[model samples]
Target chain A: MPPEVEGGETTERVLQILSTSARLFATTGYDGTSMRDIALACGISKSLLYHHFADKDEIFARITLGSTRELVQFVESRLPEGAAPSLRIRAFMAATGEYFQRYRWAWIASTTAFWNDPQQRRQTERMLWRDRYEGLIRRLIEEAIAAGEIRPLDVPLAGRLVLSALNWMHRWHKPDQGMPAPEVAEAYFDMIFHGLKR
Target chain B: MPPEVEGGETTERVLQILSTSARLFATTGYDGTSMRDIALACGISKSLLYHHFADKDEIFARITLGSTRELVQFVESRLPEGAAPSLRIRAFMAATGEYFQRYRWAWIASTTAFWNDPQQRRQTERMLWRDRYEGLIRRLIEEAIAAGEIRPLDVPLAGRLVLSALNWMHRWHKPDQGMPAPEVAEAYFDMIFHGLKR
Candidate 1:
């Protein structure tokens, strides 16, 4: 009945539309899902979906931005200020596994295989984790070498490899398979943290 | 000029078709690629392309089967008649990175992302890498621990985690990016073989 009430309802509806769209996209996939599917899944009209998102990519970008925001915030908190090379490296690798479980997004990361193929759409979301964290790992690697914590090697390469190992876990890990998330995180840590060599 | 000429021509054509198809599928992705695309890329007639492989899936299967064979053979050779645990584990991890690089269809391993989705037509091709390599890694983990090479942990989880880390390199690694393959392998090996703790 009132303009303010109408505006509030429209914004709430738009949020509802995006929240549902993201969950579906992350679970099903970006290409596999249809706008109609999102509309039906959301129990909303197509026109209402349009009012919220210009197209699938619009909704996808919004959802991706939302996920990245949470991820950036999580990284900000999980990584402590001025932790040591050994501790920071552990945290860095652990963040990979832990973040996936925390966000429930290994599927989203892997399915879209976001790093490759699409050059520009929503590129900022993909870089959020790497840009925020790789520098820290690079510094830790350099510091660790100087402190004799580990061997001298390229920092960025190691960062990518470590991230790859953690990111790839989403391809095989099924929470329903009785595999504990902490165990996966710990095993990865144990193997890489101490080296598999005796 | 008869049998030998025909046999050589057949094999050449087959190999040509396979390389073209693999490149196309790897670049454009499988769903976006069609018989026409492959044929056009190779400048071969559709009828002749049919002679080389029955369809896209058949060509795709050949690509996968070939990769699986290469990977399995490499690991099997590495696991000698009486090879030591340390050597076997190192060689296994090394071979994995190499094998993943060789195969164009390695992206198929990201099936869980699109598990229930329609593009997952080549599910077997994707799962085979994990099934074969994870089994081999599990055996290696057990042997390595028995031989006092690794910390005590669940073998299966350790194996999957290790494979996840090593094989997932394809996600970020591009040969054109100036990162050498050996260096990448060693970067992982450094973190894995020596660790970061002081």
Candidate 2:
């Protein structure tokens, strides 16, 4: 069961727990982290941590599900309605990068964690959210193709090409490095949209 | 020191040990796997496993270094000496796919392992090989730009764009699944070479 969110205080405390857990999981990796470690990191007693989360797996599941939900909502909020397909696609990429930068640790934890455990409800739900995100991108590409803004190519392949560049950033894109995530995403957008032909 | 290879039989036995260890590390993850587990999986005694290598770290390091060396050689051997920069890039990608298929587990383990382990010699050496591989691609891009075969752009960024798509494949591309890696790579190459815009 999901943790109880009794009120603002309880919700905030839960968020704090999740935030600390995400950082631990992101840096040390899921296997290396434990509930005891999370509690210690959060300066809470083990009983208190367990009061909020049943176990490490539940905490991880909560973080992954919450991160993906926020990602979808953030991207949807930024997508411009009635804009050209290409602009909409660029907007999608930019919004994704912005979200990633804002929640770098949580995003990393969610993306890199092993989510294929046997028929777990939380894992299944997270996959559904991921599918929604992918579907949204595919629809944008399909719209672009139909409008003749882009070449008529394989829709799934096109979607993967675009998503691959954006998705792989967490491995290399430093949080406070040379360029911000959104700008780096724009560079990728330019490359994908404009062929390298001189 | 590296494992001793006294003769052809010893070399083959070491290869067998490395191959089994690679598959375990690839599937169970480096941390999730144990030296004893590797020995059990290999149907060998713990003493025999210890005789081959010091520990799991050494086995992982050997697999990573060997896989990278083979990758460099395979890509270089496939590269056409006088071909256009574009064709050469395509060849480089195709060769990577072939190598990946041939040594799927080893490639997966090497690429996904946490290599930044505080200045260990094997990890450091593996990073050097990885750098060499990246440098090869960057030089190829530089040649393409100089030859006027492609638009002059941020060479590193362009290289990242291409590598990201190819590198991200291990996550979603299953062995014996929908499309072969080379064909998938070709589609990516086409989309990257000719921009999505008509």
Task: Give iRMSD, candidate 2.
Answer: 1.9
- Which consecutive 10 residues in model 1 chain B have the weakest lDDT in total? B1-10
TM-scores, chain A, per candidate: 0.75, 0.91
Worst 10 residues of 2 chain B by lDDT: B1-10
**Candidate 1 docking class:** medium
Query: What is the DockQ for all candidates, taken in turn?
Result: 0.54, 0.64
On TM-score, the candidate that comes out on top is 2
Per-residue lDDT over A155-182 for candidate 1, one digit per residue giving the tens place of the 0 to 100 score? 6776665666666666667765664554
Q: After superposition, how far is residue A119 of candidate 1 from its true place, in Å?
A: 7.0
For model 2, residues A67-174, the per-residue Cα lDDT tens digits are: 888788789989999999999999999999998998888888877775233227888898898889999999999999899999899888888888899989987899
